[model samples]
Target: MVNGTNTSGFGYDSSTHSVIAEPAVWDSYIQVHKEAGKWRNKIFPHYEDLCIIFGKDRAQGNKAKDFAQMEEDANNEEQSEQIEGGFEEQTTENEDSPNIGSKKRKKVDDVIKGITIAANLL
Candidate 1:
């Protein structure tokens, strides 16, 4: 919110002389201008160039999206690195594993006394 107003949504588009209601329309207008070879900024372009692209209401929505994507990408990269490091650390930690519960049961056989280790454990 800038100037106590959320400047992101439908706004007036004087470039085509109409109110741009959706982001898709604004993006198309920019693409059209770029294909026409006249996409540019004239010094203080806040009221001139950007107004044509986003209109009066959506001043920073596109920029905000770009920044958000950049932040997400950075986070993903960091997470990828962390996962790779985890694998490396896991291999070393497995050497001192606390898996004593999975150890094989000791062998015992005493048919006369009726004491025997179950075959299922083998």
Candidate 2:
């Protein structure tokens, strides 16, 4: 908390139950939370862990709805990352393949080849 531009001190408002922090300290807190959010996303793969990180109140807050939203956000974020960075590593320019993996591509290619041969014979 800060008082009258003084750099050092903690001030509490009894009514608000919140500390008034210096601008610099407040900014630091914001930055720390942003970084922690990144780590939380990476470390917590499940809804329970996310709730634990967010707080118990969050875990209990309309859990069916809130947890579903969290999972949706996580999935959308992962898919967006994969779309942007080409994490679908096994995918190719070919559109016929349904799966993104070497084995799947091989199977698709064989099917295409057989179809081509049948078309030529006809």
Candidate 3:
């Protein structure tokens, strides 16, 4: 929005011939201007030929969104790589026999036999 003269209550004084803005209106105006300045400072980081140029293209706000997407993709790739690396480490640690637990026979076979019998009855 273009900056306009404040005219939100106080009228012009005849003696000074200058518009006398109300205190509250003036405060609000100053605050708004301050915020606009902040935004301009953030977006337009550089100056070229007295014209403010945005850090990125003003027209392509989509570029910021694309950057966010790329960041998310990078994060996902990092997580996948971490998981694959962990699996690789585990495999290397147990390369000789993958199922080391299966070599040790236990009482679980009797339990499985009982479960199978029960399942057949059902």
Candidate 4:
């Protein structure tokens, strides 16, 4: 015989000094635990793949090699754009200014020559 006030057959029991567990609460907890376990299992493989791809240095996350490759790609793209005449020639109206146009043209030519050499290397 429980000695506390019972509300709809579930309430705090003074004799047991503990709150009765509702069935729905236990069911929800179980469902959440199961879902968490399922997701962990599903994601573990991808995590392992990343570890393999990144190698032992995965923990540091430095990715220096990747960053260097990206920088090289960007430089190559910029060189290509320059070769394609992507930059506009800036002309100064002052006659006293040295031949800026010739200098700029020479710079573009040098970049073109460098890219040509690199292409020949490949």
Candidate 4 structure quality by residue, lDDT tens digits, 1-122: 11235453434434544434466644554476765333221223254345468665543456455655766887788778765653344434144345776677789779777976886576
lDDT of 2 by residue, 1-122 (tens): 22346644445444454455555665665576765333221222253444456654444544545645765675677567645545344345345464555565477557756855775575
**Ten-residue stretch with the least lDDT total in model 4:** 36-45
Error of 1 at 93 (Å): 1.0
| Each prediction's TM-score versus the true structure | 0.26, 0.23, 0.27, 0.26
How much is the lDDT of residue 70 in candidate 2? 68
Cα lDDT tens digits, model 3, 1-122, are: 22126446645444544445556665676687775333321222222322343433445655455545765675677668656755665666576565543332234345546755775575
Candidates sorted by lDDT, descending order?
Answer: 4, 2, 3, 1
Residue-level lDDT tens digits of model 1 in 1-122: 11236544545455654444455655666576665223322123264555457665653654555645765675677668657755665666577663421231111113312421332233
lDDT of 2: 0.51
Clashes of 1: 0
Task: Work out how many backbone clashes candidate 4 has.
Answer: 0
Give candidate 1 regions above 4 Å deviation.
Answer: 1-65, 96-122
